[model samples]
Target chain A: MIDLFLFGIFPYIALVILIGGSIWRYATKQFTFSSLSSQFLEGRLLFWGSVPWHYGIIVILIGHLIGIFIPSGVMAFNRIPLRLYILEGTALALGLLLMVGLVLLLVRRSTSPRIRRVTSTMDIVLLVALLLQVLSGIGTAVFYRWGSAWFPQTATPYLWSLATFSPKVEYVTSLPLLMQVHTANSFVLLAIFPFTRMVHMLSIPISYLWRPSQIVVWYRRQAR
Target chain B: MDVRAQVATVFHLDKCIGCHTCSIACKNLWTSREGAEYMWLNNVETKPGTGYPTQWEDQTKYQGGWEVKGKSLKLRLGRRLGVLSNLFFNPNLPIMDDYYEPWTYTYEHLFNAPPSSEQPTARPISKVTGKFMDIEAGPNWDDDLGGSPVYARNDPNLADLSDAERAALFRLEQLVFFYIPRICNHCLNPGCLAACPSAAIYKRAEDGIVLVNQDKCRGWRFCVSGCPYKKVYYNWMAGKSEKCILCYPRMETGQAPACFHSCVGRIRYLGVLLYDAERIEEVAKSPETEMVAAQRSLILDPKDPTVIAAARMNGINDEWIGAAKKSPVYRFVKEWALALPLHAEFRTLPTLFYVPPLLPIAASSKRGKYDLTDGEFFSSLEDSRIPIRYMARLFSCGNEEIIKTAIKKLWAVRTYMRAASVGDISDQRATSAMSELGCTPEEAREIARLTSLPRWSDRFVIPPYQREDVIQQLTSPIGHKAQVGFGSNVPVRRGP
Candidate 1:
């Protein structure tokens, strides 16, 4: 019953809240969508925190997506013992980098009085949740070992089943406790995503590269 | 010609008394919100002192406005790719210390304190953190040369002065300063507009007012670092950048902006200026020495039939063209050529102009009588307490000749007026002085009247915005009737 609810029911609930909540917020309260940067008040520490955190988390998220999309490719790449070690080593290093960056950011939020004043209760909750997720991820990599080699075989199928609207409990149910926590916390993050500053991730501003340098808006007939 | 009409301004610096009525009026109307406590949309600063953001004119540090390379103009902040990388961590963005941490007094202590032997006092607390703090600096920390040794002495404009000239400026007898009131220049090539990654900042085609779309602004803060004048301020609570909107809501209703309307000294002048939009980039890329002249040529003559026809073709309408013809800004900027744009070298083609102050002459008391050291009826231009070189740096990008000509014309007007009313100086001397600058007695009289005795209507020639016609083009008038007022119905809070 627990496995059925966790894998089948909770994922849909989290997805509904993430998608529905984001669209609702964007429609009714669009102005609230922002990174809510505290760099103006305290920049020196933010530079140390924000840069590494973004770079590390982005790469890790892309890695997870790759495992889901091309599980066969990852399995082929990890066939050789040397290749598997390299892949696992790189993932561990990146996960550690993410941890270090998140810890610095947390310290900055707590220690700086100016930053603390702007820090919301939701922000604290999100940060703590993220720290726990990263810790569980790192623990899975250490204890379970060969996550890159096995992720495709077990987690990928489970995720694909979930995406296709079919609940598949057998694949993830047998995974270690840390691996389960990692998967469950990711859904938790998704559920709370719309309510936090993390929505700024959707606003990447890539279009700025191609847009005209100057923008002149016309209220009446256009100027010649 | 792609002609467009811009409502421009001119500040006659000679008439400014350094009173901060404009700043106060702007504060009361627009920026009296929680996140905007530190912002002063209009501020008057002593010229030889660091401005509100402390050394804003020092472009080397701030990296604002534009840099001309060969024939192309680019934002000093960096290219598009550079801005993208720095989007997360903007190196040039001014910290709170740069503009001073805003503070308010704990006034409740004064009212609620129990009876004490010592006088009850209100200690200052930070507006951002809400913690007790020692008040160190403010928006106008160096107003009227307050803390002159620290702020005034370090002025970026004084960088090129000779050692002797610099020393003479600070001497007790030679000490001089003038007020320079500043608002956003609403530049033709606005750096703030160019640097916005989200395309949130834009210039209005109807009138050249630059505005930030509150709904689109993602708060990357490039606009803050992009404006050379440091006019754009980041509202921490709203997580968006805000600037002087030029009181457009009021202007649309045919009232002057709050700052312009409340100017205590009557130094502010407003009017429409028709310009060729196609040449903005070309004008902005002019060489440093020719920047002022290039900007002047950019403002098309409204009285010219060709320009008028072009303006009409561009949908500027007859009312704006008529207002442009009678614009005080045109008279001050192009006709008499007495006014000059502030920091034209910034290459923004600032619409605002300043009639440089004819500062008090350096005179000495000899035998209990004030004696002009130069021994001329109008003291020699070189004898003016504030060096012409300094004014050149401020106005004409180190073009001393331009500053000298404007000052000479201003002095000629003063001499011409004194001869007519006071009769202390001979008419022959005044006429000769006026003729030296090719200024006739009639023109001098007109200048003096407009300078000193302008009525409310004469000072502010607000063009008919015809907002109804403009709005009708985008949406049905009946449909738009419900949302006609200023600001969003929902209060702009930080997060969902």
Candidate 2:
């Protein structure tokens, strides 16, 4: 039952909804909120609020990348034995920071008349999804521990199976359902990447450093 | 770097009287804001003295631009290099406060004290509120660019005098300096457009105008630093960057850009030229010697039948193509066998062309100073002491070969403009389309004439975007959430 739910069912549902839904959102003309004025922050509440939350999530994401992408064998040879502990600690701190920041951001968005008017229902749900991921990741990292010699390598492969549509849940079963939910929300974010301002990440400006601040003048005269 | 249209500019330094009308015009049109009160986009400076932003050209102190080391082009300083080019130093970028002080005005004394009228009849006395506002100086304020306390010694044109002569000239305080006019280059390969991670800034396919789509901007300032020219400014108040729009709105109509229309010197021209877009990368990557070779191949002779055909497909016309083919401007800018990039080492292939200044006949003759003598209007053909001409060359190409060729490329613009004004329509089809679009026949004729001329400046008109297409794009939600298949009812488990 656990296998069916974690691997077979959850993976398939996530793949379709996260990936397919995002593509459709971008293609279809429903409700979009994009404007030049979105970056204006009227008060300190909004400024301090969003800064920490967004930063926390970014930090957590970086930790995850380092842990998953770096090969364990290479890490072992390099004598980097405390990698998990470091990542776990960072995840916990960032998770707490994220929650605090989210509370501030959400409160401002909700209570402030102007911000409330601008925010949509979807924005709320997206924030909630991120919150759930933060909470679950922090909870698992703090409560669960593997022996120093043995590293659990099943979570990522199980994730890959779901990504590829061949969900196998036996290894992931050891993980709390909350952890599965957290990972699942991450996929949802990925699916939405192309359809949101998140797409700004892919831009390339080759001459970013040399932009000068001067006026360019071109002249012409009457044909004489 | 496959630019559809070749955008270029030619500045006649000798013609500029430095009245600063152009700077005022641009400031009124754009940067009249509380935060931008001190920002002067086009201020002229005395070279040897402190400049407005204080030593902005000292790149050793403020590191910017790309440096090639074998194969890797890396960021010199900042977390972006150490952190996978994704993370960077926090946006609290080093500011003027770190270097100097900022000053502000206060008018509180008027209310605090009583003033006197008539032989000092008492009523409300005013004083300049002595609140010491910390005024932080910018990076380019030190070298005053040969203005104000001006003399032969400090002047670029007069830097060769004996030390004693230079001292005598300075003792007399005999030099007068004024401001220069400026605007966006809208470069062939715009740094701002390239640096945008979101690809929000785009160079128009038809006009080579670079613009930023406000709705698509995410407030990332990669373009701010990326542009070696620093033409792109960060609008901190708006959270988005802003730049000179090239007056596309005016261009769409049968008019010139505001700056050109309002210019007192009449030194601007507008025309079209064809270039191979695929060669930009080659020109950008090639060594100095190879770059000229690459560009020579790419600069098309618009009069050639094959080139004309290709240009026409891209919306260029015969009248314009013909004028460009015959244009001395074209030969000087491209074929002069000497047109070089302003800072070729920067790697951004800018399209603006500049003709270097002709050195004055006498090394020291201050002849023929003609004053309008009528309400601050005056010009002189003789005073070769002023280095405005040399300044123009400096702004365009910093190399000697390009400079010499540019000086010889005269009358190209004049001939083209004359040919255009008389209804020698460059592209008749475009003219007819202008008429169809509700423009007066006279306006259409002028566009045909102006565009056909082999010059780079002309009166401009704005083009129209597809309203329905833009509306649809604006109304759509970027990210949407919809329920899909069944929920995964996996049992909740605690960590072992």
**lDDT of every predicted structure (CA atoms):** 0.87, 0.47
True lDDT of residue A57, candidate 1: 90
Can you write out model 1's per-residue Cα lDDT over A52-100, one digit (the tens) per residue? 8888898998999999999999999998999999989889998898888
Supply candidate 2's per-residue lDDT for A155. 60
**Candidate 1 segments exceeding 4 Å error:** A221-224, B365-374, B472-487
Native-referenced DockQ of model 1: 0.64
Among the numbered candidates, top lDDT falls to: 1
Superposing every Cα of model 2 onto the true structure, what RMSD results?
A: 14.2
lDDT of 1 by residue, B409-486 (tens): 999999889989999899999999989889988899999999999999999999997876775323322232222114
Model 2 complex DockQ against the native = 0.06
lDDT by residue (B1-496, candidate 2, tens digit) is 2224444444444345555566676567555553343344544444334343343333344343444555544332332433224322223222323223223444454455565663432232111112344343533343333333432233343333456544443442333333334466666656566556545577766556677665445456556556655556644333455676665544544445556666676545444556777665556566543444455566677666777677666554444455465444354455443234444445566664433333332222235553323221112222323343333324432333444333333223322333455544354533443343344455434433433342433322122333332212222111111111012121211100
Model 1 docking grade: medium
